[model samples]
Target: MTIKNSGKFIIQKEKLIIYLFVLSVVFADILGNGNLNLLYFFGLFLIFKNLKIQVSFLKDMVIFFVPFCLMILGEIFLSGNTFSPVKVLVYSLKILVCISLLSYTKKRFWVVDHLTIIKNICGLFEIMLVISLLTINKPIFWRLNDVINRFSKTRLKFLYSEPSVLGILCGLLVIILLYYIFDNKKNYMLLKEIVLLAVIILLTFSMSGIVYTAIGIIVLFLFQVFKNKEVIPRRMLTYFLLGICLLIIILSTNNPISNRFFSMFLGTDGSYNFRWSAAVNVFRKTMEITRYWGMGLGNMNTPSGLSFLLNIGIDYKFANSFLYFFTENGILGIIYTIYLFLICTYNCIKSSKNIRPLKVGVLAFAFVSQIAGGYYTDPILWIMYGIVCSNEKTVIN
Candidate 1:
């Protein structure tokens, strides 16, 4: 190829890889079962194959790596956990892959139109959700399972491992789609996308998803009110009251969604109870035993306090991400995690006004990551951090 053609080819290849990496992050749950996510592996392979190790990328890696190595090694030697080394190795590899992915995205696509990517992701999610529902009983590639329950029978997982994953992701997607609605004015297409995502979240019967959506909407409304001083706060107040009325209506009904919502508040929802009650206690006891350090990476899989509270023979881990990180990596890990967010917040603040909405979506995702299920190795989480920390010379229009 000519030199000009070769330059065009390289740019095209970069765009293709960027899209593929994003797809891997979004649909990572179905890429493989359990912790062995094929998509994550695929992402690492792509990054390494097209490796361009910049100084900044190395800096980002070291900042996160030093703390991780300290915690894992400390637990292995100081805590004397027999299984700690193997688990630490596995977890470290996953973290390395995610950090590399983050660095590549920040360096390459810093000025790209992220709104287009967000919209495309929402479209793909809608397509997958429809296919999953249509093939609910057929055991197709998109439908993970025909989930049945007392409320919202036949939940749609949409290529993910479970309903809650789909739900929480869709909830986050709604907030992101909303972020693209410039000037707080939702065009027809944006409105439709948000509504569709909200419906998907409802169908999954994910309490965390519902709560995130509610909170996200409130945040956006408040954001608009503050950004446009001419607008009255009554708009936000009206939404709050409307939300209360809707809750009352839903609570009065005899449906699966309502039952799940009611059960959550009553502490009767098994999933909710397991996440907050048992998981919280397990985190607390692990912290006490581990002191300022941690139980070490991958120690949660061992026979810990979770089994006693769960009353199960097998081992379990905390489903809440905040508790999981705290129990495994202790105070230092927690501080590093916070620092990542603070860095994102600071960078986004320094970025152009057009991209500020993304800051809100990122913060909302951060909150959901804590309450919703998933580990620190979650690609979507890292991707958010990457996008927020991208080049400051962003042009969203």
Candidate 2:
């Protein structure tokens, strides 16, 4: 009896720890620098406590960690960046710890329960959004603007460091809310929640978020239409029209949000050109130095800087996520990473019929946003991957 009771206590403790970890991940930006560091330390401790350290886990870790380490080594030896390896190691450790924690939790809990946990995390973000709205007059709640271009218009970032960051978070929540609405047809609350999330994401003015969310909504609508024999359900059509109306109204306004869509793509703006140039420069530099292997991972932004792009005052350090992976880890690193992605995607599709649309939506949102927004360091992306690849069967024992 005592042994059984002790086991239950341990399980409960681990569950609480997992919840804490989720909170930390969702609110990492809002937690402040010092507080966030403390949360990470606590997370590491919980991960250590729950970790079983089996051979399989070790193998998985090596598969994930080796590419990153090789990139760092390349930067050190080939690129002659002595000081960058520490930064790379720190970044890699955070990802490693998150991967380990999610893997451990998935083994003990049902995948549906993991979905619930993620939903709760989204709920917390909504709470934060409410607080941010209330505190908009405060200096801390002010929007972020371009530091180099002082004349550029500011965009709403809320509690995050940038508009795109807030957009990514809200975009994921919108996907989750959409999934809930599809899964529970009678849930009126979810429909309203989706509207609210959609508004928040638009307010962020993140082009990546807007595009990804638009694509996800379209895909979901198509899936429903196909499933129902090409018949568009009245309720779904009504909601779709309502969403379109909201977007039209929002875009008609003379706000920064409206301006972003026009200015981002205009040739005179140079933003699109800048992104292209950044990606090209990174790839060109990587290819110039190494053919099969990469130049190592610490910072791909060469110290001497790329040709005319850097000279023109554009910082080409962070390119698209996939491009960054190729430049940092070379061809093999990207292949291995893509293999992992394909495996996760395959599992998600195989289990789509058994799982809620929320799982599938999360997977879709993560893939699209990561590719478009260059959020290579985001923990939520990896967490979603872990959830999608988890076993479909609910824990019975």
Model 1, position 33: C-alpha lDDT score:
76
Residue 298 of model 2 has an lDDT of 40
TM-score of each: 0.83, 0.78
Q: State the weakest 10-residue window (summed lDDT) of model 2.
A: 147-156
Which lDDT tens digits does candidate 2 get at residues 12-57? 9767876776666565677655225434565477567646677645
Q: RMSD to the native, candidate 1?
A: 3.7
The TM-score between candidate 1 and the true structure equals 0.83
Q: Every model's Cα RMSD, please?
A: 3.7, 4.4
lDDT of each: 0.67, 0.61
Which lDDT tens digits does candidate 1 get at residues 153-202? 56666667777667666776676666655344444477777778887887
- Which residue ranges in model 1 land beyond 4 Å of their true spot? 1-3, 22-27, 108-110, 139-150, 182-187, 228-253, 303-315, 348-354
Instruction: Return the top candidate by TM-score.
Output: 1
Clashing pairs for model 1 are: 151-256
